[model samples]
Target: MIEFHLDGRSGVAPYMQLIQQVRQALRLGLLREGDRLPTIKDVVAKVAINPNTVLKAYRELEYEGLVTARPGVGTFVARTLNEEAGAVEPLRVELRAWLRRAQAAGLDPESIEALFATTFRIQLQESA
Candidate 1:
């Protein structure tokens, strides 16, 4: 099961946010094919959103062939986006250490994120 959270400040529609979270989970190997998603009732209780919002997200995911809904059971992941699980942990550890170094240099979280985003964009542009 995956826990979902919303960021009201993200400017993304709530239903889209749900869909993105599911996609991100799939990419991160947190959600695998055949895993059951939280029921609409459970998501409504947890996030206090309209049930239709969850249904819409699930439907969109189904359309993408990432998930399927069974009539009386629950929604399940039908495919995953994860490619390489073995490489993620080491990169995560290195990123954590880099974050600590940035904090030690007196950069706040916002500054660190901005720096990372800027550098990431530059790298992408250079590669392109």
Candidate 2:
């Protein structure tokens, strides 16, 4: 079973967070076909989020063909999405080191996160 974690302060919508987590899990091999997902009731009770938000996220996943809902039971993983095996990991490691350095220099968590986001957005736009 995959447990959902919502970052209410992450500046992302709750449903998108849930949907992204599912994709990340699939890429990491943490979730595979036939795996049962947390029920809507369970998610609401555990995360204190609206049930419809979770349902909407699930619907989006279903539309993506990554999961399917089995009425009377619960949602289940359907397939794995694309995996960029040769990429991302090294950049992630470097980013982590940079984050640590920022922390050591007395930057608080929020400041570091904001700086990273700003830098990422600017870099993305520049590359485009």
Candidate 3:
């Protein structure tokens, strides 16, 4: 089973965090087609979030064709976003090196995260 986690201080919305978790799971091969996601009740109970939030996240996944929900059953994984398992390691290594440099430059964890977030947002806007 895939477990959902949230970072309350991450500045991203909860629904978006859930959607990203599903996508990340798909890319990392942690989830496969036909795998049922946690029930909305279960997610709300475990994560202490509103049921509507969970539903919204699931609906977004369905809209993206990454999941399908049965009327009475549950949401199931419908597709994967990645097939290459090794593709993330090089990026992870580069990220680690960047982190090291940031720390050496006297940047704290929060500062580095903020800088990265700002840079990522700009990159996303440019690409779009």
Best candidate according to lDDT: 1
Task: Provide the overall lDDT of each model, using Cα atoms, as 2-decimal numbers.
Answer: 0.95, 0.92, 0.92
- State the lDDT of candidate 1 residue by residue for 24-49, as single tens digits: 99997899999999999999999989
- RMSD for each model, in Å, please? 3.4, 3.6, 2.9
lDDT string for model 3 (19-102, tens) is 999998898789998899999999988999989999999999999999999989888998888766577788889999999999
| Per-residue lDDT of model 2, residues 1-128, tens digit only | 88999997899999999999999999988998899999999999999999999999999999999999999988999987645756778878998998889999999999998998999899999999
lDDT at residue 84 of model 3 (Cα atoms): 62
Clashes of each: 0, 0, 0
| lDDT score for residue 122 of model 3 | 100
| lDDT of candidate model 3 versus the reference | 0.92
| Residue pairs in clash, model 1 | none
